[model samples]
Target: MEVKGKVVVVIGAGKSGMAAAQFLASHGSRVYLNDIKTRENLEERSLHNLEKMGITLLLGAHGDIAGLQPDLVIVSPGVPLTIPPVAEARERNIPVWSEMELASRFTKAPMVVVTGTNGKTTTTALIGQIMEDAGFKTFVGGNIGVPFISEAEQLQPQDVAILEASSFQLETTESFKPFISLILNITPDHIDWHGSLEGYIKAKAKIFARQDEKDWLILNGDDRETRALAGLAKAKVLFFSRKHILEEGICVENGYLVVKLEGKTVPVIKPEEIFIKGSHNLENALAAVGAGWLMGVSAESLERSLRTFPGVPHRLEPVLNIDGVRYINDSKGTNPDASIKALEAYPDPIILIAGGKSKGSDFTSFAEMIKDRVKALVLVGQAAGEIEEAVKKTGYYNYYRVETFKDAVYKARDLANQGDIVLLSPACASFDMFRSYEHRGEVFKELVHELAKND
Candidate 1:
């Protein structure tokens, strides 16, 4: 935790890395920020600002890690551990910590961390709201837009730090233990980055690596992969399920979200009363309620937050209803499983906009669901052909392959009827066409708004 005079190397000049560099420099650590990208690829102002703070910028290559002889290495979530510099640091026995790991060392606050293949953002945000509504000073960050290090140092013991941990971040974690941890659900995702499905699951399991009996670990009881990891936690394990009633833990029973712990059944809220719809969102709400309850949040506060929280922006967010046709933006559905859940949320005829940068996901199941749920499919980006092929194998031919993102939206609009839903759930990543999933959702919303004006 003492970085007063240590030489530190922060890898990947992204948001998390920049925060880490600035944080370290402010704390008197001699920081060197490195990236595989050249100086031209990054923003000029950000680079100059880092230099102004006395943090050294090492761009273009990572070979400088050896020459700098850093005592500690901080890794951004997006940077793979197989990178030469990271492996070299391990080989040389230099301490390597994730940005989350580095951030956790500075905070004495009770942390509530959420991790899984899906629903992490919504679950984390919901938990933050519940804590805040309960009158607790809360800081919410991590993989959910803001870096944890940016707010970690400022969190007091009485404050709460609610973080959304990604597999990428958890894989590099050393001493990042949360007071409460929730594994919402695990599925095959980010295989290209994690090397395999088993590897991805291992990274997710790291969320509870350092927790003890004092901590609480929550798992999704409905998810097979997540339920199988119950024995790995050293902390007390709690399960949340939407499909089954549990003897202990949170679950939906007889139209109510209830927590049954220690032979006491506490009815929290009704699923119909929650602002966020869908089985996945219901599961997220259950996990949030469990975390909030474990952290001493009142039942009234949890229900109030769940009733009013308007869900995350990019996940099944309602955009506009033009001519009785609902247009939805679910751009955060970056995997086939997420898109499948999005499809399951609605019963209306759907004109689904899918296909983006493939994350090595098997689309056969997604394609099968599209055959039954989707009225029409408009595909775009790098994975169009692959998705189309999968759909074809399922004997679903009501699909159009568009050349551009704008065209895909326009085509979906044309195909949708007044009673139908036009949904933007890519089921893949957005890096093929846009900067990030947020950018992709913003553009979809803008296009939908523009279409309304034109109509």
Candidate 2:
């Protein structure tokens, strides 16, 4: 882990990559930060700051790792390993590590890593809150915004690091093993990046690949793909389910969130009492409860956190009610399955704002759900035509396609009637229209608030 005066190459100029480069340079590594994007395409302030810090910037093309002969390469999660420079590094026997892996090498804290297709953010945040309420110092970051490397060196052994491990982050891990690894549920997502569903699942499995008997792996018993991974885990497996009562994991029993593990039954809280609603959030709560209980958190602390956790901003978040029509921001629904879950959360007739950058997701199921639940659909961004076709194939013709994101929001508002819901739950990535899902959600909220001003 000592990197004094070693040549290191860091790929991607995004948040994680910049953080990794800064961290490595501060540790006295000769760092070369590279990105295929030109300096014009990236954040000028951040790139200028990196250059000022003495880290060499290689923009507009991939870095020549073979020419540099670096000791190690740290890759941002968004950069695929198949990129020539990374692959070349591997061919030359250079150690390639993910930002998550590199960060782990510097931290002594017991890590609680959460990974899955849909609920990782909510579950990771909840676990951090629960641990903090139980009097443990916590550092929460990974894919949830801040890079783990930014805070890795600051954590002590008694502190806990709650991380949201994405498939992209887990795939490049070499020795990154969390003390507690939770797989919320596995669904078809990021297929374009991983090449296939199997490949994505394989990446997610890396979260616990290095764990031994003393560690824990939490799975969702309700998901077949997630449950099947239990046989492959060397760590002790714990399952959380929303569909059925589990004999030895976490589940709902008699309207209460219950945990039956290690020959003990602990009723955590009532589902209705929890701040976040929806069946998906219930599963997230069960997983968070498992992490907290396993960490020896008191039932009182768990209940307090669960009751007060106001839920994440972009997932099923309420914006404002305009003339009895509620507007919801679920911009984190970056895939069809996530949007489907968002659709299921509401019983009101919906004017759904969907469509963004395609992620190779099949929209038939999402379309079917919309046919049953949505009163009207307002599509925008890159995948609008595809989603509209899928909706048409489902025999649901109450749909409109818009050119701009603002237009889509205004159209949804116009279509929504009293007691109806206007939901911004695009079933695709937000890169086509905004910087990220958070940006997309923020714009949606602003537009909704603008509508409220006129009301």
Candidate 3:
């Protein structure tokens, strides 16, 4: 772990790269940050900040990597292994690690890593809060908008790191084993980025790849893809289910969340006690309870955290209720299955705002869900036509296509009635209209607030 004079190269100048470069540079490692983006594309302030930290920059190209002769290379989650620089590093036999893998070497804290197609953020945040309520020092990060490397140096042996790892992050990781690894569910998502659905599953499976008998793998019992992974996991696998009563993991029984380990059963909390809506959110809470128990959190503390946690934004978040109409910003529903779950959360008539950059997802299931739940559909972004085609097949004609995001919001408001929910749960990525799902959700909240003020 000593990096006193070692030459290290950090790939991708995004958040993960910035934190990794800063960590290595501060630790006396000669750090080189290589990014595909030019200086003009990056923010001036961020560039100056990295320079102040004494990290050398290799921007706009990957040609300089061969000359660097790095002793080690750390890649950001977004940087794929297929990239030339990373492949070149592999060819040179230079030790390559993901930012999380490198961060794990610096901290002795036990990690609870959560990864799945959806519900990762909510589950990770819930587990972190559960640990905090149980009086444990916890650092929450990874794919939840904060890089683990940023807090790696400050961790103590008694602490725990709750990470919301993504498939992109897991693909680059080698030695990133967690004490408790949870896979909520797996469905077709990010196929465009991972090249294929099988490829995406392989990357997600990496989260528990290095785990052994001592560690725990909490998997979703109801999800077919997740259930199939039990055979591959080397660690002791536990299941969490929303449908059936689990014999050895976590599940809901007779309206209460319960843990059944060995021959004993302990109830955690009722589904109604959780502040978050939706059966899917309940499943997230179930997974968190499994992870919390593995981390030695008391049942009382787990129930307390479940009841108090208000849930994360961009995932079925209620912005404001105006004139009996609820505005929900589920902008994090970036895939067909996620949007389908969002639709199932409400029984009220819905004016659903959907469509964005398509990830090559099948819209048949999403359209079927909408046909029953959605009263009116407002479509925007690049995938409008594809979604429209899918909806038309269901004979749901109460749909409108908008050229702009703002127009879609206004149109949904105009089309909605009292007691109806205006849900912005796009079944596509936000890259076509915004920087990210968070950005898209923020914009939706602002627009809803503005509409409320006018009323």
Q: Candidate 2: which stretches are off by over 4 Å?
A: none
lDDT (Cα, tens digit) per residue for candidate 1, span 1-455: 69999999999999999999999999999999999899999999999999999998888888758778889999988788888889999999998888999999999899999999999999999998899999999999999878989989788999999999999889888888899999999889999998899999999999998999999999999999999999988999999999999999999887899989999999989999999889889999999999999988878888999999989999999999989899999999999999999999999999999999999999999999999999999999999999999999999999999999999999988898899999999999999999999999999999999999999
Give the TM-score (vs. native) of candidate 3: 0.97
TM-score, every prediction: 0.98, 0.98, 0.97
- All candidates in order of lDDT, best leading: 1, 2, 3
Error of 2 at 138 (Å): 0.2
lDDT of 2 by residue, 1-455 (tens): 68889999999898899999999989999999999999999999998888888999999999567799999999998888888999999998899888999999999999999999999999999999999889999999999879999999999999999999999899888989899999988889989999999999999999999999999999999999999999999999999888998889998888889889878888889999999999899989999999999999988889999999989989999999999999999999999999999999988898999999999999989999999999999999999999999999989999999999999989998898999999999999999989899999999999999999977
**Deviation in Å, model 3, residue 321 alpha carbon:** 1.7
Off by over 4 Å in 3: none
Query: Which of 1 and 3 is the better model by TM-score?
Result: 1
lDDT, residue 164, candidate 1: 94
User: Whole-model Cα lDDT per candidate?
Assistant: 0.93, 0.93, 0.91
- Which residue pairs collide in model 2, if any? none
